[model samples]
Target: MESLQKSLLVTGGAGFIGANFVHYWLNTYPNDKVTVLDALTYAGNKENLASLEGSSNFKFVHGNICDQDLVEQLLQSGEINTIVHFAAESHVDRSITGPDEFIETNIIGTYSLLKAAKKVWLDIPKEQGRQALEHRFHHVSTDEVYGTLELRDPAFTEDTAYAPNSPYSASKAASDHLVRAYHHTYGLEVTTSNCSNNYGPYHFPEKLIPLIVTNILHDKPLPIYGDGKQVRDWLYVEDHARGIDLVLNKGRVGENYNIGGHNEWHNIDIVKLICQLMDQAFENDKTLIEKYPLAILARQAKSEELITYVTDRAGHDRRYAIDAEKSFTELGYRPQESFETGIRKTIEWYLDNDSWWRSLIK
Candidate 1:
């Protein structure tokens, strides 16, 4: 059977998960067209999608999702039928320090995109020669929206109540509500996926996994928050893309799906794992010592010595776990990468692509 061609407007496509999703979609469906709209913010890196610039099926637009007019123009002109909304102010630390950006980008920006989607896809009257295309608005959200879970609490499911404590998560919760409202009130075709923590290549250095890897190479102290007992579910970025692909293709509208890796680890454990991996990498390949001369601890197979505990952030969630059973049973979705396999690939990527991350660090 011939595949259905999708023209996707991927907001925040220059960011970590967004860029990975763009690559996955284009590579999986070669005939489809993808237009990335990004503001190139501190977290948004164009180099993430640099390789696809010349591809006829790929286009990148440096812009913000808050610009409703611009989004509408792209939707109408490109005849975009699917909108993968990944744009947001995602960092919890940043949200705690400066909540205004999170509110603007996460809440208002999502509102803007929804309005634009509604206008172009629902409000506009189809003109002559215009194809009567079916439209879908897929909102990509985080499991944090379900708030922190207690040690004995069950993993968050599609029915989980919203109790966001952080500004970042609160804003995302609002956006998820808005997406659902648009679908119910105005009859916009929509699907939402709330995913657990994602880690992989091109991840910004500010995030945990990347931070540990990069700081190790720089021979800097690895900061652990509080007791580092905070538990989080980690999903590989490619697996996240695969979950989203299933949602876009097989998911039902007006429904929400949870995508998780089922791999839960304490923050401190993850740090130690990365440190062990680094030490092993350096011991196995003597040349890594030369490449990362500053990683003195890693060279001696003692990277864990750099671990340092810092004061915890305000309103830090104790745990977040996703029960992806709904997505698994309904859409036949399952994460392909085990944390063991994924972390190795992530470490190798960082080691191989020093230039890509060095630019961001400095």
Candidate 2:
């Protein structure tokens, strides 16, 4: 396959997974022009992309995906034939507390982008008697849209029925449906990937892995909900980026791919693993003890002592696993990191980058 020099408009490029994707794209294809549009929400931190500010091929735009006019302007101005849509309200807890933002951002915001892309990439080109621009609107989504699974239940495939339980997942499901509609009804070139849980550098500390690593450093309680038996398939953020790259380069339009790490673990087991890793880190480095005096438990090689059981929240999904055979066979997508390697990398990131995650803590 011929490699195409891409001009990409990456929405939500300042957030955790999004920021990592931007970094991966720029590093892998230095010549490609990449533009990021982000709202700088609580979860969206511009600091995540601070290093990329000096890159000649990178541009960051402060804007909301809900602004159709702004999205249209950007698509036209950059001649962005590829849009990597990553903007969405993704937290399940936040969705339960307030679902309005999820619906507005995940559903309506997606609609806004689709409208803008249709106009600039398709409608206007036809109106001006120009050749149709080769374009792809690749929507990044989560496997949570498939809802929970039983212990013995089959993992979620691209063909899994939608059974979202939380407002966040429901909104994402709606947006996924809209993306499919655009492709089938209007002939818009589009692809969607439902990815497993992503963890790595730049991940907001609110999520499980980072939260435990951070809490361990602060000597704070490691809260486990409902015995922490809930299972999830973990995907490294960079691996997810690689999967999307394959999709853009060679995937079939109107198809949905599942990107997974192929590594599943219980929530409690994950927390325990981090505690063990933290203990090892502190043991290996005496400076960690002096640098983070509050990490007394980790220093003592007893971080698990801080573990505290808590009542689980309502509508908590039991297990989520993704079957990525389709993505693997069709797009040559496979996660490069296993849970052991990925989690260790994640812990080291938090240990070395205190300045980054510390600023986010209120």
User: Candidate 2 clashing pairs?
Assistant: none
Write down the TM-score of every candidate: 0.97, 0.99
- Which tens-of-lDDT digit does each residue in 164-210 have in candidate 2? 99999999999999999999998899999999999999999899989
The per-candidate count of clashes, in order, stands at: 0, 0
lDDT score for residue 322 of model 2: 95
Score each candidate by Cα lDDT: 0.93, 0.93
lDDT of model number 1: 0.93
Cα lDDT, model 1, residue 299? 92
Model 1: how far residue 346 lies from native, Å? 0.2
- Model 1 alpha-carbon miss at residue 69, Å: 0.9
lDDT of 1 at 145: 94
